[model samples]
Structures are given as C-alpha cells and as structure tokens.
Target: MPDAKQMVECPVAAMLELIGGKWKPVILYFLGSGTRRFGEIAVRIPTISRKVLTQQLKELEHDKLIMRKQYKEIPPRVEYSLTDLGESLSPVLAEMSIWGKKNVLEKR
Candidate 1:
C-alpha cells in the first residue's frame, strides 16, 4: 500500500537471489550435515571445478548463508559451516531431498 515509487520484490525471487544457482543448494545440502573443508566439498561434488566452487562459496558467504573460518597455522586451514541464516534452510533442503528421491530417483 505504498507509493508507486516504492519497489516491491517477489518473495521467491528474493530467496532465489540469495541461493539460486546450479551449485548453491547442493553446497547448502552438504553443509547441513556439518562443517566441511574445501577438499571435502570438492570431493563430494566431483564435477564442480575448483574455481567455480570457490566463487560459489564466496557468494554464499557474502549473502550471510555460510561462514568461512581460517585457522592460523604453518599450514593454513579453512573450514566452512552454516550460519544461523543458512540453518534456516534445513526444512527447505529436506523437502527438496524428499521430492528428489520420490520424483527423480524413484522414476529413474
């Protein structure tokens, strides 16, 4: 009920802006189990190139969906985990999993 100059966004579109992509949801689903190192994620999603994965992770981090932590040591260590915002997507991810299993996997 605002002025015509006010901009409105579709809820789904807004959500997609934060998490839409070929890999964001997959990344989120994997991280749902727990924290993961870069190599571990790379291994799980074998098809994604390291460059693309790194870009996706950066975008997710910028959106506040994931946290990237760097440990100080002779050999630098990094781990990625979900932020509270990211955890909120668990229900959505669960539903997607169920849908995929029933509609995608079962039919195949």
Candidate 2:
C-alpha cells in the first residue's frame, strides 16, 4: 500500500493516480480486450510515441494492473495482458465507452 501521505484523501483522485492519464486509460482499454504485443498496442494508439508508451506500460506494470510476459526466442518477444485487478476495471471502461458513444459521438 502507498503511504497515506503520498496518496490523496479522495478515492477518485487516488484511483486516477494509478490509471488516469492521457495514455494509461487508453492503454488499459486496449489491453482489456486481450493480450497485445508492444507493436500491437502501438498500432491501436497511433498517436502515442513509442517512448511514452514504454513509460506508461512500466507504470501500469509497477501498479500491478497489467502483466508483462517475455518469451525466450531468437528475437525476444513480450506480450501484455491485464491482471485481475486490471480486468476489474472492465465495467468502468465499458460504461465510459457507452457514455462516449451516446454523449459525445452521437451528439456530433
């Protein structure tokens, strides 16, 4: 657990600290569907730079929300999938998607 001093008292704010960001949520959303390779994730989110994606992935891994698996092969391979905790956010992501389609996409 993080030190109380390090975490904001507000639950939402603290939750945001783990998953909130321009890219983190997006990354999680993609991973929510299934496991993805580094390139696969990059392809889904074209606007994210490789460097930033790497950083965000590391943070999510550190937070225990995602799992990174490496396979021993001639050309090294890594894949990412959500942990149980990460999958727990699926409903939240689903709701957000529905809301976006209704309130944002449909409005336009």
Candidate 3:
C-alpha cells in the first residue's frame, strides 16, 4: 500500500491529465476509424469551434497520442490519425462507453 504522503502516478490520473477535456476524447474517438482531415473532424463534432479543435489537435500531437500528416498540393491537405500510444487508449475508452451506457445513460 502506498503511503498517504507519497505521490502516486496512477495510470488513470496520468491519462486524464493529458486528455481530460470536453473534446479530446471525442476527437480521438472519431480518429479511431482512421485518418481524418481537419474539416472532417469538425463536421462530425459540430459543437466544437474550429479554434478549439485546432487547440485539441495540437495538444494531442504534442503528447504523441495522435500523428498529424500534411500533404503538399495546390490546396494543402492535413489529416490526423492515432499513434500507437493513442490506439492503445481505445480499450479504456470502450470500457468507459460501456459503463456510461449501463450506469449513467440507463439511469436517466
């Protein structure tokens, strides 16, 4: 057992510190299918502002959770996809989804 005075870095606590927000997980959820353009993600998560989406994407990329690829062309193209670290988070998200459905949503 950890001493009460000791600081412990629990996995959930560490993860939440990185991706805890209104949009990060949802952004990741959409990216789970594969790569997506900025506009594509914005379309699916319509409630989030463009500015917010950009911020979240930057943060995810910085944390090495998502990879951003840019294509050079007449019209520049960019797409976001999960890194190996991010893909590993899918199981955790799935469990959260199951619990939310059973305990939270079902209660309502």
Candidate 4:
C-alpha cells in the first residue's frame, strides 16, 4: 500500500479511505453471506444503478477486499466473495449495522 501511504498516514482515516463510500459498505455486507453474481448483488441492492455497482465492485477488488472470478460460459459468468481480510471486517460491519439500526434508524 505504498500508494496509500503517500495519501494517508492515520490508520483509521486510511481504513475509511479504503472502504468508505455510499455503496461499498453495503456491497461488502451483502457479500459476507457467500459468493454472489453481479445480478444477485444488483437485485439485493436495487436502488444502486448497474454502472455504479460495477464501479464499486472494481474498486473493492482493486483494494484486495473482495475477489472477482470470471468463468467461461456462453453469456460470461462472474462471481464475488470476500477475501480473508474482507471476512475479517464482518464483526465491524455487523456492529455498524446494529448501530445504524438502533441508534440511527430508530431515531428517525
């Protein structure tokens, strides 16, 4: 992450820089279940445009948080799943989700 070092020095801010976004957290949370295809993720998060989803997935893959596997098939097949590091974020995401529900959503 030499490139990251050039931009961020603080650990927490750097972590946010890597994964913080309107869609990244949700996308990562969904993938925690298991491998899913592009369509499946799109279906799960219907409000997200396909273009944005594609972009976010690429960024997550680039950051080594998720893995993308392409398969040879008639229409082309691809799948996404969490890397070990990605899975390691599950507890953190879970707490965020819980907090969002209890402290954030409930107040609304």
lDDT of 4 at 32: 95
**Candidate 2 residues 42-99, lDDT tens each?**
9999999999999999999999999999999969999999999999988888888899
User: What's each prediction's TM-score?
Assistant: 0.89, 0.89, 0.89, 0.90
Superposed model 1: Cα runs more than 4 Å off: 1-8
TM-score of model 3 (CA atoms):
0.89
lDDT, candidates in the order shown: 0.94, 0.93, 0.91, 0.94
- In terms of lDDT, model 3 sits at 0.91
Better of 1 and 4 by TM-score: 4
What are the clash counts of all predictions, listed in order? 0, 0, 0, 0
Clashes of 1: 0
Q: Please give, for residues 67-90, the per-residue lDDT of candidate 4 as tens digits.
A: 999999989999999999999888
Cα displacement (angstroms), candidate 1, residue 45, comes to 0.5
* C-alpha RMSD by candidate, in order: 3.4, 4.3, 1.9, 4.4
lDDT of 3 by residue, 1-108 (tens): 656444356766678989899999898888888899999999999999999999999999999999999998869999899999999988888888798999999999
lDDT of 1 by residue, 1-108 (tens): 644444346666678878999999999999999999999999999999999999999999999999999999868999999999999998999999999999999999
In the predicted model 2, the residue pairs found to clash are: none
Worst 10 residues of 4 by lDDT: 1-10
User: How high is the lDDT of residue 10 in model 1?
Assistant: 62
